[model samples]
Each structure stands twice: as C-alpha cells, then as structure tokens.
Target: MAHRCARLCGVTALGGSMTRCVLATLLLLALPVPAWPQSAPARPVAEDPEITAALALVEARLETERIRRKIPGLSAAVVYDQQILWSKGFGFADVERRIPATPRTIYRVASITKLFTATMLMQLRDAGKVGLEDPVTRYVPELQLRSRFADSPPITLLQLATHTSGLSREAPMDYWRTLRFPAVEAMVAALTQDGERIFPPYREWKYSNVGYAILGLALSRAAGQPYFDYVEQNILRPLGMHDSGFQPTAGLATGYALPEGDAPPKPVFQPDYGGYGPATSLYTHVEDIAKFISLQFRDGPVGGNQILRGSSLREMHAAHWIQPDWQSGWGIGFRITRIGSYTAIGHGGGIQGFRTDVSLIPALKLGVAVFTNTNSDPDELTAMVLELLGPVVERAQQRSRPAPPPAPAEWRHYLGVYRTDFGSRVRIRLHEHRLEMVPAEEPAATPVVLTAIAPHQFRMQGGWASGEVLRFEVDSQGQVTGVWIGAYPARKEALPE
Candidate 1:
C-alpha cells in the first residue's frame, strides 16, 4: 500500500485600518480577475526531497547498469500525470564521431511500433469505419493463408491485435535473420504458403509479426491512405511528437552489438521492416514517447481534434488473452503484466541493434520510457526506473494536493471492517469526500469509490459491483452496526491491530 502524508502550512492573518480596508476592497472589486485555466501547469521538477533523492538514485543506478551492460547509448524519461519530470541520456549516440547522447537521441523502437498501429486501428474502430470482430478477409480479401486445422475459425481484427490470429511469428522471408524485408505485395503473397498458419485461431497466445503486418495492410485499406501517412498525420502530428515516425531523423543513434568479455562493442546494421513496418519499424526518442504516454491518460470525445477516443484507449489496454501462469496477458498492442502489486501495461521492442520499452501505470498516471542503442533489455531498465521513482512520485503528488475537507462527524460511523455471512471481508474508508470500499485480502489494489445517493446509502462507482447499492444499518444511537452491499448483508467488525 502507498503511505499517505499530509503537509500543513501556517498562514498569518493581516489587520488594517477600516478606512484602508474599505479602499483596498473597493480597488480589488473594481479590477478584473482572470479565470483559472482548464488544467494546471506542471510544477517544477525535483522540488521535493523525496523526488530529488529518487532522481539521484535513478541517475546513479542507470549509468551503472549501462556501463555494466556495455551499452553504446541509452536514453530514458519519467512522466507523471501529463508532464515529463526527468529525462537524460548516457554514453555516446555515435561512438565514431564522439557524439554524446541526450534526451533527444533517436533509436529504433522496433516492435513498440505496434502500439501506434493498434492506436490507429482503435481510432478506425471508434469512427464506425471498422469493427473489432470483423473478419480480416472483409478488408483484405485478396490475401489467403493455408491452415492445417480445417475447423479453425476465421481470424478477427481483435485476434490480430491480441496475437491470437494463429499466424506465423514472422513471414517466410526471414526478415530479422536476413536484414532484408519484403515489400507489401511480396509479404502478402508469401502468406499463401502451406505452412503459414502455425496454430489454430484462439488455440493459444502467440506473438506474430506477420499478424501485425496484415493488420497494417487492413488499416491502410480501411483508411484509404498509406499506412505511414495515416499514422503520421493522425497520431504523431496531433500529439506534437514531431521527432517520431517510421523514417529515421537527425540524431539517430548508432546501433551496437552486445559486448563480450572486455572487448569494445561492435556497431550493428540497422534494418527497416518494409511491409511489416507496423510490426517492427519505428524510430523515436524518449521525449516523444513521453507525449504518447500522456495521450494514454487523456479522456475526451472521439471527433474533431481529439486524437483517439479515451474509451477506445481503455478498450485497447484491457486484457484480451491471459497466460497459464496468470502473471501476464496480451492487450491490443500491449503486454500486460502483474508487476508486484501494480498492473503495468506496456510493450518492449528489440531489433538487431536497438532495444526499447514503454511502461505505464494508468492508475497513477505515471510512465517510464527507455531506449538503448545496443541489444540490452530496456524493459528491465524501465522497471528499475519505476521501482526507484514510482513511489516517490506518488507521495509527492499526494503531498502537493490541497487537503480534502474533513469527513463529517457523523459519517465516521460508517468507517470500519465488515464481514459477510459468506466469510468475505471488506473495509470502508473516507477519502477526498467519498467513501472507498477495499477488500481485506487485497488492500493495495485500487479501492472502489462509493458515492452517496441517500442519507445512509451509496452507489458503487467502479469495479464489478459498480452501480450497485450499499446501505448502512444504524442503531438508535446513530452508530453504524452493519452494512448491506447489493444483495448481501454484512455485520460490522473491529479492525485488526
């Protein structure tokens, strides 16, 4: 559980003569008062002691890890809410030229490109132009694949997005092994081979680059424009991610091979995915990816200048397939995992010479993006950043907020642990003017908000019980004795020590 700390400040009251006070009041009333902006600007970075300490730890640890791993160049960014609080780089982007890396250093993000492709597809779905359940053949009728399982269901767009399409992990062209990728027509044509389908649709979870390549073609056909143009004009331009796109821009970092023993690392060739661009071809920096992470937290309507509907974004983040271990699952374009107590949704990318990852905790509106020019795992680095920084940011945010009005004196009666007849337990607590329901077994999970609908009743605002009623049973002396949540009755119990 995240510990909450409250900060108190003292304010001094001023006294003035009645004549001066009247004049001052009149002057203030006559002048105009500007309206507050829709959203507050971000506070300056590293203002809190905890945040400063966390930043220091992150910098020291990141550099140590980079050198220990023998990476050529690496960049990272930490974003809270909608603002980037910290971003820096280490090593050299171009070792031959002796160029130092910075936050703006570009690296091939590889499979992370699927996130943008998934976003574009969700945008098309929300626009009423396509459907998640629609068959792939509906958009790309010319493409066909031979499957060993004759009874396999036709693949849907959702399957492609979630990696349940039964498609091969890569096309027969062996692009990753050969550094030479096929063109659009050639990739689609190769799908007709006898061994293209490795499994029946929905049989199991399988990561497929060919599936996303097909998805990109479908998106292009549906949007009536080139896939690159669609993503550039819609997702990239509106988010102010000017440095992000399919093509490389200035400041592109040189890719390097993993170092062995004490020998210096060797540079590796950078290759484009050609027809599989949506699956594994993207170049970007940490700063620009931070902007994309910010978009994941926004809520708005679908049309006009609004990039993608917030509802669609949530749908994309929702898990569509789960692994047998129950530790990880596949979302639309994201790999969702149970990391400690938090549910993290993000993606990792690895090409010949680059490794990248973007992990976001939407519940906290916090994210971390890491990019490396060598074959090191940036995903693990991203997790390390979160481990060192996530909590400090949370505490700092809690301390910076204006305190909520104290819970009403009588309302405190409802705050306690309650046990149902079936042996389940729940706790009710007041927070920021609302009641929160938390499971006794999972106190660290996000609590369900309960909003008052009557004097002694509340409506669950989230979770599976959302929209259900929760009523309190009060004694003659006005003390809460029990609670009825939906159809179940529970008696109040003393809290644990």
Candidate 2:
C-alpha cells in the first residue's frame, strides 16, 4: 500500500524506483508492530503463599502440642509431591544436656523397621531367589514350631508378611526393658525349646516380633548376607538413606522415657531386638525416613537405583489383610489407612524410649514422618500432620490454573438446597464454573468444590466432602431428581414458582 501511494505521488520518478523501494522498507520498519498474541504469564509455583503459610501454622501448633503431650523431643518432616516441604523439631532431644532435636536427629524407629525387613524379602522375591508363598520352614528350618491344624498348613512368607503367622509377639523374656538381645543362634535354639504361639498358624492376624525375627533369618539366608547388611546395601544405601541403619551411632538422639508416676524424663538405651532386629531395631531420623517413604511411592528405580520391582511395590502397598473394627489393614509391610479420602500406607513403631511413624500418600505423592525421643504415639502426630496437609495440598495442586469446566448452563434448575435423610442440609450452588456443595448448617465448614471425573459423575475436589461423587439423576420427563452422595440420596429442594 505504501509503495502504491509513493508511486501515485511520483516519488519513484523524483528519486528512482530503487529509492522508492528503500523508502517503503524504512517506513514499514518504523511502524509499530502489534503484539496480537502474547504468551501467558508463568503459572505460580505450587508451593507459595498458601502452602507456606499453612505449614508455618502447622509447625507452631505441633510444637505447642508436643509440649502439652510432654514429649521429650520430636522431629518431623513433610514431603509433598516428591519434595520435602519442611522439616523441624521441637523441645530437647537430650533433656539433661538440653541438646535440641532436629529432623536429622537419629531416633530408634522400632517396629517401623519391619517395613525395611519386608523390603529385603521383596527384593529377594524380585530377584527370583524366593517366593512369597514359600513356607518359613523352607528357609529357617531351625524354627521347629508346630501347628495345631490337622493338615498343618505351614506358615508361608505371605503369612509372615501379613503378620498372620502364629509366632509369639516377643521372645521368651521381657527383652524390652532388659535391652539384652540374644544372638541369632540363641534365638533359633530357643525357637523349638521354649517358643510358643499366641494363636495357631494362619488362624488370624496376630502381630509377632518373633515371627519377623524368623522371617529375617529366612531373608538373610536367602540373600546369603546378614539381615542388616543386606538391608543397608540394597534398600538404604541405594535409596540415599545413609543416615538410616539398625544400630545406635554417635550424635544419635538420646532416647528418653518417663519414669513411672510423673517422674522427669530419664535416658534409656535403644533396644536391640537381637535376632529380631529386623522387626524392631532400626534407628533413623525423620529426613531419612521421608526419603524411604518417597521410594515407596515411586514404583520404579529412582536416581539410577532399582530397589524393588514396581509390581512388588504395588503389592507392598496393597491392603492384603484387614482386621475387624480396625481403621486400617495390613499390607505386605505397610499399615494401610485412609486419611480422609486419600489412602495412606506406612508403619509406626514404639520402642522403649522412642516412638516413630511414617505415612505415604501415593495418590498425592506426599509423605510424613515423625520421630519422638519420648514414647508418645508417633502415628497420632503423623495423622494430625496429614489432616492439616490434605486440604492445603489440594489447594496448592489446583492453584492458578484454568477454572474447572462449567456444568451445563441449564443444570441450574437442579442447583438448590439438598437434604439427606440423616438431616444434613447441603446447599448446591454453581460457583466459578463448577458445582460447590456447602453444608448449609455449619457456618464454619468449607464448601466442597467438585469436578467432573466422568460423564455426569463428579468427585469432590476439596474439603471433607472429597471422594463423594455427585451423579445427577434425571427423570423420564427430563426433570432433575435427587443425587446420591453415598448410600443416602439427597433430594433437591423445589424452587419457588
């Protein structure tokens, strides 16, 4: 257009065709170019104002709770989506010396060690050296324990994995207070001589430290290395959990116990399970345990090391045995529970002086580990942390993205008050292009915003209402009917004419 104008005005004759062409090129360069389509701004990093703020409050409340519980010291680490969001400690790890505990502070992990022992066995299983169905006697024949059943079904590796083996809970003595762990040879000798069963083999779920002891012996024999050595080399070292092991080391957190009747916290020796070390002797801090937890969430090799087969890892997290009236069930080594709608699988340990717990949420890729020098229930602390983390993480994961897809515009006819038969009233309202279900009776309750996961099927994206699917029921006349929240149906309140 510029060239045509210049030619009509006789600029080509005034200068030359070459000059006119040059002028047109310069004019085009000087004109402002419109940025018609610019790239979108960077999405906020998931961990920002909200996640960090909630975490700060979480830390403060937990510290206060620690003092209230009279816990000598506690170290905690929270992992979200494969990264440790934060790790902190409260109170004195060593009361007499006033040494502060830290997330790196090593404490006896106790029964949580069973998971690692189970990991070694799973490794052997992956290597094709052993089978889960193989009998315990096949490897550890020294355990000449008998069964009461007529066709005595031998206690298999599966039984030991699920804690259903009819082995005694402890060794013949009260070794907990004594801290005198017998050698593997001595434990085996006493197996046939004095060992007894609390229940018959494969009868029921009975947690047995001695059962794991024999299982460890079998694992060690199958791996052709000592139990501790095999676990350290294969599971711990490969996963970069160098600070984790089965022995008490220098600078390790001093174990403390409250002398009966409100006495001040006193130091206690870290218990050695002797031959049963795999069941209860492992010592590690929160950070290392978090790493180990991360590995459990990862089904494949991480950082160039493959510890267990992916199929085996899924098996480890599976709820194989469920107990009556229990909130959770037993997996291969992990104790599986529900943290709201999320499935958390891990283990907890309570030794003489220390209490520890580790929980991993595979769906959210989050893990929490708590270690206490005092014998408070670490699982409770971990559960508290998970409850605090659940909503905050859900918000973080859903941050600053495009809004949830809108429900059909005409569906507003169904948006009204919904009442369950149990008298729980919910107000269903469309907000920000999604369905929000708010418990109308509770002023303090957070509304659960739901998203469609399938055709006409919505899952609660946040709050306590999570995992509840709202499938709208349409009548033959195309009028909206009640929606099923669970077993109960929430009938929609009629709109005013």
Can you write out model 1's per-residue Cα lDDT over 104-177, one digit (the tens) per residue? 99989999999999998898888888899999989988678887787877888989999998888877776667
> In every candidate, how many clashes are there?
0, 0
Clashes of 2: 0
lDDT of 2 at 436: 79
lDDT of 2 by residue, 1-497 (tens): 76675555334433354445545443443354332222433244344555665576557556756766788898999987557889998888888989999888888888999999898878888788899999988998777764555655677887887898777776676555677888766776776777755576656788888778888888899989988888988888987888888777865888888545667888876555677777888878888887787776666643355577677889888888887876778899988898888888888898778888988788777788888987787788788778767766665555535444456876576687777888878877777677777787674567787677775567876765567777777788877777777456888775612
lDDT (0-100) at residue 474 of candidate 1?
90
What stretches of model 1 exceed 4 Å from their correct place? 1-47, 303-305, 412-454, 459-467, 472-484, 487-497
Candidate 1: 10-residue stretch with minimal lDDT? 2-11
**Would you list the C-alpha lDDT of every candidate in the order shown?**
0.81, 0.76
- Lowest lDDT sum, 10 consecutive residues, model 2, at 33-42
